[model samples]
Target: MTEQKQETKCITLKGSAVLLKEYLLYGINSILYQRGIYPPETFEPAEQFGLCILMSTDPKIKNFFDNVLGQIQEWLIQRIVEKVTLVILNVNTKEVLEKWDFKVDYETVSSNGNADDNGDGKFIEVGSKDTKTIQKEIREVIRQITGTVSFLPLLDCLCSFDILTYTKPECDIPKDWDETDPVFIANSQEVKLRSFSTSIHKMDTIVSYRNT
Candidate 1:
């Protein structure tokens, strides 16, 4: 009974992927709200990671995240996604202003779910960390994101946002996916935030803004 109870607490690759997707969902919404890309009234408060997160109520924005992050979850399980970026830019001039990057690193998982010498370098089916602890780490990252508004320069012009996902070169690009040049901010200043690991995948976040 003890072993069975402990087994239920194991974090699997799919579970980690789901958690990653949720973090992106909440993090992006928080960015949108904090940066004032959308009107503050368009978002509603919701509880996540023990924090009151403001999620977008706009149907279009909601659907966009659902579809994009849904696909990202699958790729994460496959260990193919490299990074996901949220780019904020001026709507009129189309100049890039700020970028938030979520970088992923794949970790080796043992076959028996134990980190033993006998296990070969493959994939982690069952991870080592518990869900509760991971959520706590996520809470801190989100808190830092909210605090960034204090230092990040104001967007004086009308602005909009877009999400970009970087994948391994051999990844199978979906027919609906279009290739685009990488977005960059000239004379950018970057700040790295705290990282969280699921024992299967490690995530690091960095935010860069044009030093105007």
Candidate 2:
């Protein structure tokens, strides 16, 4: 019998960005459901990253994420985005209640000639790691976010969430998007969640809340 060879998985920049965007999409949905930003009945059960996740069914909310994450994916491909934050605030007082920061780091690509090299002597960043491993890591991060309800302070007031994308200074800002000051939680308690990497890009997540 002939020996079987394992097929190599090649991860390009565009593929990496798509994976990151998917994580953000499901991750934000999980947060909204767990934090009670909307009525529990408004969300429906969905499966992602091998976990049953609750996703928002509200049309406005769904539209919001689609637009925001779309721009973010482009930035991720250009390696211009720094962090994407989901800020939870009191609708009445505009007080920041919680902040979830998804920080991005571009992995260094080796210059040594390999399969990733183009004919022009320039190397394209490529990830050889299997997608299954990356998805497993994402699963753990989502699980941690779900577990945060245990220790996080109850958001008793009406709360709203805004997504902020931090990009490099050289990055061009879209006309529809305005520059806003970063939100911070006063006297905060922070918990860093497990991070996942696609070999081309590494992501770290941290959640902060007001200390009471």
- In terms of lDDT, the best-performing candidate is 1
* Tens digit of per-residue lDDT, candidate 2, span 103-132: 999996433344443467656566766678
Q: Residue 130's C-alpha lDDT in candidate 1?
A: 86
Worst window of 10 by summed lDDT in candidate 1: 110-119
All candidates: TM-score: 0.92, 0.90
Output the lDDT of residue 177, model 2.
92
Candidate 1, residue 32: how far the Cα is off, in Å: 0.4
lDDT of each: 0.91, 0.89
Model 1 scores a C-alpha lDDT of 0.91
Per-model tally of clashing residue pairs: 0, 0
Cα deviation of 170 in candidate 1 (Å)?
1.8
Model 1 lDDT tens row, 1-212: 99977775688888899999999999999999999999999999999999999999999999999889999999998889999999999998999999999999998765554553346755447877889889989999999999999999998789999999999987887788787878999999999999998888899999999997
